[model samples]
Target: MSSFAGVSVLDDGMLCPSTMTFVSTSSDCGYHLLVVKGYARTKETPNGQSILSHDFGVGGYRWSIKYYPNGIISDRADVVSLYVHRLDDDDGKHVEAKFSFSFVDEVEWQNPVYIRGMKTCSFSSDASSWGFYKFMKIDALERLMNLDKDDCFTIRCDIMVCNAENDAGGTQVLLPDIHRNLNNLLHNKVGADVTFEVGSDIFSAHRCVLAAQSKVFMAQLFGPMKEGSASLDVIQIKDMEATTFKALLSFIYTDSFPDMKEDEMSQATEEEAVKYEMWRQWLQNLLVAADRYDVQRLKYICEKELCKNMCVSSVASMLVLAEQHHCHRLKEACLKFIQVQSPSCLQTIIASKGWQHIIATYPSVLNELIAKVIASNQQLVLK
Candidate 1:
């Protein structure tokens, strides 16, 4: 965070003003208050014109509020003239907004005199302002001013800006692309600094990116207990296979799973079945890896992928994996696949080698599955 210090020229030859220096890094859909103090005592020239406020920012553009106490033209001399004008270098640009201008009563703050309806307008260089020539009668304004003890008045403007244009009829500015370029940089592996050795496999990555993305990575690679390295450093990862490590790195970098042909396992051929089985095994391993690394998004992705491929042959193993990883969604999906979607799937799963291991390892999960089955049998009996 940089402090604003009036005006300064950058090395890039761009003049930066303190007021316009801070652009919000996040989305903002809110209101800005424009309070004009000493409004009743504003200096009015012989031409009956006065500028109350100037150079105020609202929705990334500069604006001013002009006031005429005795009206701008001779024909409208009995009334006040009030107009909100754009002062920014938005030459061909148009700003659309709905605004209200009102005079605040000092004694009864809630009972301020408003300009009736909200005035909606598209401001451009040609049609810059939308205002009322007869904002209020001159005599009424003077009486209101005299009633106040301090002889001071307040005027407030409430503006709700919708959007701004590049030109008068041009395209609107789009939202910031937060992840697009970051994803591209990761995919390209550009300027990679650190390397990880998982088993016999080596993965090149950026340390800053890894540290920024994950707290575990930050602790291991950049914290006080970090392995000191200058550049092209190789750090060994324990208790994880090369493939699982690669998948974890892919998610860390791209915020998505790595590109794999097995992701599209639509065919029913023996070859496709083998590929699908491999994919499911990888997802199961990735789920455990995600939990180990504390990557919630990757864990969710793995859980979803495992759920999609759950069958009689894999349900018991998946149930074991879900219980071990504490993936409630995946565990529930496994239970439903066995007990509800296909009750016969349970018989095959119980006979599998992993079933005895699940019974020994996760007795509570096995009890939950039995409860679901007993509940299903009771429902069948009732029918």
Candidate 2:
């Protein structure tokens, strides 16, 4: 035993905010006009004289307002009176709601900082209306809402209908669909601030979204050189093809490759075989473009597709691509293909001379691969 007894210690008794748990509420705002066709009838109307607004719905309930011209009571005649009437079922069921009314001028401000009295009201069959007797002074209302000059003024009512309380598990919500919305934005070009010119093809995009996705784009669009392309003029991209850039944009907006139905070479005829070979070349060009733009995912995708389409003729070029684009796995795959071939088989492949393009472009890479082939053959003889 310790010498401490069952004594409670308070760490400097204090009050602070705790996690919030409360009932949810659904709310909507509806605007209705309080206009005067002429100054005469507006002022001449007797006290308690009211005009009704067309019905508007809020939170599944129909509501309309009763606007009293000279106030509902005699003593309050100098002010305008407004009452919101519920036109829903008159059954014993009651609705617990709170609402606020403000002039249109206040609601349309940069920051609507209007205030209203507190307290939620219960509306039942017997009590179906709630209101303010002194909604506003007639003279002040006219000045704020431009009633005297505009010939009409509007009032806004914001209603909050309380929802049922959630259990401890809380409420389930819908999944966020950011990709679909971003794709829509790309097609719509509603707030596009930048335009790209690839050869003769023009494309518009938002700079912020591009910056968020690619550091290369961020540097060109917002970094030190941004001053040159600051205006609406098109920024030229000379090296990339229009099709490749289009696919890049699709990935940027949707984080996915545009759906492509790749031809399977093993099952394809001679015509499809030609298309399959063309696809392999496209992947090479696309990989180079992705690397230039620093789009790592697209670059990796290109590398993987090239590896899947690799053949004896593509060995030399694939080896060069592997080194140039940081494709270590692809390099290993290419080396493995070389290591499994017999010395005579390699001679026949070299005789075919299908790798001449890579040999002309990257002679050293082919030479190194040839050396690896000789080393693997010598080891096979020793085995």
Q: Best candidate per TM-score, number?
A: 1
Q: Tens-digit lDDT track for model 1 on 178-211? A: 3444556666768888788888887788888888
lDDT of each: 0.64, 0.64
| lDDT digits (tens) for residues 1-383 of candidate 2 | 01111111111121112211211122333333333344434556689876665555665566666777688876668778878777774644566556666654444532323333223566767889888776667875676667667545445555655431134434322223366578888999999998899999999999888888888888888887676655635788898888888888887886665544452432358987787787787778888877877888778777766765688777767777787777887887787776677888667556554456556776776677779879888998999
Q: What TM-score goes with each of the models?
A: 0.50, 0.49
Instruction: Indicate the residue-level lDDT of 44 in model 1.
Output: 39
lDDT of 2 at 66: 75
lDDT of 1: 0.64
TM-score, candidate number 1 = 0.50
